[model samples]
Target: MYWRTREELSLENRLRRSYYELLRDELDQFIMAHALKESYENFKNNNVAYPFVERKELKPRARIPKDEFSLHNSFLVIFVEDTIPQAYKKYIRFFDVNKTTKTNLLRSKTLSLGPDFDRSQKFLDSVHFYHFLKELLPVDYALLIQRDTSHAKTKHRYYLSHFHVRIDWPISEAAEDLARYLRYISKDVYEKGEKYAEDVQKKFFEYHALPDMIGGRRTAASVAAQYLRRLPFISTVYVSSSESRSLYRYCEQGVSRMVLMRLTTGEMEQVADRNNMPVRELKRFYMLDQNGRGGIFLFRVTYGHTAPAMPPEDGKLREIKPELFWITVKYQHLLPLPGIWEHPPLRVNLIYT
Candidate 1:
């Protein structure tokens, strides 16, 4: 082919350059969003890190790792602006990268570098979305702790693990804006600062039935082990403080617990005879220890099986809810494992400042 004149070639090059620059300016209009860092003052540790994601940092979005139960119904409303000169685009088009793995909400923005742009102003931010995930993780995790999946066949109780109340960001419309808003569906989560945990937990405990407990001290670990060792069979004991109303610092301390003990039908009858009342009419169940002098509440285990005999891992306790933080037992007379109080799963505290 005949070579084009140098003048013509230069003109062509100029036109191409101008076209490319226009595309660059248009692309700059939308800024890749990132999570802003904020201090979680309520956290006992104080100053937790919040993370945000950006466009340039998303090339490997597809390969990003995900966690289990990551698709839980965590939804949020993200408000973006429409502006010029790359101030920031108030909105992003819905970009579904891995429809099978709908984890990251920024998938579209990250993938837009190739051939995808849905310019829609509104979109869904599910639990798997990483960009703004950190902003609401505490609230979300707290919701999980109270989740009671107990059904007709399976009665699993998940008490609130650890929740730090957050007042930042506008969450009033969180339910209306998203279809998968978990707070709306959460039976345990109260509307903003309400002491709902106590009511929910009280009902759960009364229904499921917790074992009666013996008094405790640091040395009680050994004492409890020795006591349960002589029992006819292995006994599993669950220990947890009563769920207290949170959302405050320095909760006015009071007696919030009852030590319950497990006994038998004949034992109840004997106690009733001693108390001079029918077993059904007996108001109090606690009586003396082995010597029969000290009063201790009685809780006959109704279910054949007990909850997990071991302490729940950090992930289980990370959610905010009310339940005993400590549990111990003498299974075949083994030394008691460290309860949550002894070996805390999470450092975040809701009752104390």
Candidate 2:
């Protein structure tokens, strides 16, 4: 389920939630008032893509009477104005049915390439459309399709896995808008800040190189073996100060770290009892190295099963909210430390820049 901080229930969240809700509500009403049906044939085949199927072109086995040809899927066709030259109209269709194999309940559809659609713009537009529909219609699953023919190497083709996001819990209108805005800002920044983007990529490669650095496969397995050796007595291990220092630098540079631990069924029970949470509820656990001051923040493990987790009271210690949790975990855990501290790792001084 989605989790939200009480602090998130602010004016900003409320306004954004209202804005999209109102827009979607109005769109829904418009469709109903017009007696829109789920199925229909589009005769306007002005572009080379999505060729029209005339009666003669219909397959004998698939052919159906015109009266019986009702569209079984609900769709929203978005016509986007071009902000760049050589880009004509961009069409994004939202299908209200599950076509994705992983999750069967998500809204999925393909984006058709309009005449004069730029290759770069097509890709970016697909990403933008994915984020837009994600906020407009929150769902547990969503996908975007991008088509392009301009590339000299890859011919006219469809990019099926452009972007994806799952919204398992209900979100306030404001939170949704904030999410969309963040996505837009990130894309804008990446497009504008060439140096910054390159730096991030470099750091990402460095982080991936860690597994090789520590001792190739042998060293990596040794790290795992070290933890496995201690698994009998320790339910968890906290990162030491020195490791945290290294981790902080990596995080500042955008690396990621994973906590390795094996919990006994009894230890898990104790953890559940202590936290007043369920055993099956535990998914991914983490410790945050706030800034460079060596402060540690323990996060309840919540598998990427739903929205971010809500923080507990006091705001200092809480489950990672679904939205921010993954971002924070993937980036924050990069801090290096001395040793793995046990459960309730000692809190360090709070440091915020």
- Per residue, candidate 1 scores C-alpha lDDT tens digits across 1-353 of 12122355466444533443342222211111110001111221344321211112221111212221211212121111111111111111121232212233244232222235232211122222232323333221111111123353322222211122111211222211211121222322343245443333232222122222212121121122222222222222112211110010000110011112323456556656764666554322233122133222212111111233222343242232345322222111101111112221111111111
The global C-alpha lDDT for each of the candidates, from Candidate 1 onward, is: 0.23, 0.26
Best by lDDT: 2
List the candidate 1 regions with Cα displacement exceeding 4 Å.
1-253, 283-353
Q: Per-candidate TM vs. native?
A: 0.15, 0.19
**Model 2 CA deviation exceeding 4 Å by range:** 1-13, 18-200, 204-262, 277-353
Cα lDDT of candidate 2 equals: 0.26
List model 2 lDDT by residue over 1-353, tens digit each.
12233356567545533443343333332222121111111211222221112222111112222321122222212211111112211211223233222233232433333454333432322444333333322222223333334474543233322222221221122222222222322333244355534433332222222221221221222222222221111111111111111111111122222222223355445555665556443322322222232222231111121122222334242221212222222221111122233333222111111
lDDT for model 1: 0.23
Q: How far is each candidate from the true structure, as Cα RMSD in Å?
A: 28.8, 25.3
